[model samples]
Target: MIEVLGENFIIQQIRDFEDSQFEQTFSGIDKATSNIKNIFESLANKSCKIVRYKKFKQKILNRKPWVDHEVRDLKKTIKPKGAKLRQEPFNLELKCNFFTHAEKL
Candidate 1:
């Protein structure tokens, strides 16, 4: 039988049929807890790295404001031929279209 309470409490009712029953159950629970701890630690580390990188990128962007203007000018100057491409404000769509067309061959 399993009993769950609130958001995190889980109680399993195990009838002892042999001497090894309690040891097996507790061992399994210990292994599961260890695995969960490892996963949480890894995810936390990855998220911290992502946040650090974002902060670093924001600092760099702040230092070089003209970089954005140059990129915008470069996008306006480049255009694909043979397709009636609508004027997209961002270059992402155009880049994706270029890659898709290249993949067809």
Candidate 2:
């Protein structure tokens, strides 16, 4: 944004300089030198505002792409099955499927 502002400022200064009393070419060498100096002075005085540069921010999305309805349902069942394993053992097939699905991620 600062770069855009600076560019516009320079363009405005140049237009103002061109619109002023200075001629494109002078009759004498001294007159030409003086005109050049005046132009330089005008540009030098019209300084751009000093602004701090801004850093770009990136958006982060926290989501598990692999977790579908099936995965969610499996997770719901797995918690109870895991707890029940302390008393009576759960089915090995369900446990194997859960591990396989989790590892696929």
Candidate 3:
């Protein structure tokens, strides 16, 4: 699984910080300076989570051998174009075409 911070949750966290007056913690500091410091601390802290996602290794492993080989070849073709096909967003029709092509191969 690939893990990364969730941007949406982070934004919500910032909103919560504003709502909760979390910045009040540094009230002793100069108002302008404290606001800047609070902003920095909010971004730097563990208020965010590491989101996990399944990497393509599991997907390829779960497929039939021939289908997996076709996937690998498709990956090779996209490699020259700078990314894996699996990383691209696919709509229903495109996904159907991909599976159809894999089954044909």
**lDDT tens string, model 3, 1-105?**
112235665566556556653344456346646655666565666555558886765445455555666667876554433333355645565566566655544
- Pitting candidate 2 against candidate 3, the one with the higher TM-score is 2
Candidate 1 clash total? 0
Per-residue lDDT over 20-63 for candidate 2, one digit per residue giving the tens place of the 0 to 100 score: 56456555556656656765565555554557899978879555
- lDDT for 6 (candidate 3): 53
Residue pairs with backbone atoms closer than 3 Å in model 1 (clashes): none
Task: Note the Cα lDDT for every prediction shown.
Answer: 0.45, 0.62, 0.54
Residue 75, model 1, lDDT:
46
Count backbone clashes in candidate 2: 0
Which residue pairs of candidate 2 clash? none
The order of the candidates by TM-score, greatest first, is 2, 1, 3
The candidate scoring highest on lDDT is 2
* Clash totals for all candidate models: 0, 0, 0
